[model samples]
Target: MKDIEQYLRQNKPETPDEGQFIIETNARLSNVEGIKGTVDAERHRGRLMLVIALVAGLVIGCLFTLFVVFFPVPSIETELSAFSKAIVSLKEWEALLLVPVAACAIALGVFLMNRKKEVL
Candidate 1:
């Protein structure tokens, strides 16, 4: 063991010249930084798109709701056309349909926000 240790200590591994090593290291760092910048830009663009989509969805949903409330559908009668019946049924069940959808949207938003926080 002593002989092996003496041999190892006496013979050191050869290293590349300092300048070459520094240059290669700087090149690698710059490449990594470029990739980081691209990834950050993509993330920013994605977040912007998500915000736009959310705002558009909210605006359209509000406008539709307001239209529905202000212009109430006519009362259904025993004699009804297929389209009228379908519209009436949708109006009647709008709450049931929308509740789950709204919940999912809220959950998705929360999940995404949490994920962003975790990544940062």
Candidate 2:
């Protein structure tokens, strides 16, 4: 290894037209960077859309829950007694409903991520 190194040091290889090589390499790199920028911008837009959808869903869900909690149910005691009872029962287990809402949100996020990958 020492002998090989000594021989390589004695006869250093020179690349001809170094400036042209640098210019060509820089040009290629800039072209590749332009393509990368376009792809990155598209990805950013998709992510923004997904984030907006998620936030909107969250706001709607919160409003819906508040409405459910605060709004008075009309007198269904005579006509739709079973439906009224079911609603009352569901109110007791409203927290369990969040599991499904969270699952839906997670599913949507995963779907958006996968769809973005496909678009890319």
Q: How well is each residue in 11-64 modelled by candidate 2, as lDDT tens digits?
A: 998767686888899999999999899888777777776776677677766766
RMSD of each: 9.3, 7.1
What would the C-alpha RMSD of candidate 1 be, to one decimal place? 9.3
- Which clashing pairs does model 2 show? none
Model 1 TM-score, all chains together:
0.58
Q: Write the per-residue lDDT of candidate 1 for residues 1-111, one digit (tens) a residue.
A: 999999998898997569778888999999999989977876776677577657756775666556555555557655787677658756776875575467557756765
Evaluated with TM-score, which candidate comes out highest? 1
lDDT of 2: 0.71
lDDT of 1 at 109: 79
Off by over 4 Å in 2: 1-7, 72-114, 117-119
The C-alpha stretches of model 1 lying farther than 4 A from their native spots are 77-120
Query: How many clashes show up in model 2?
Result: 0
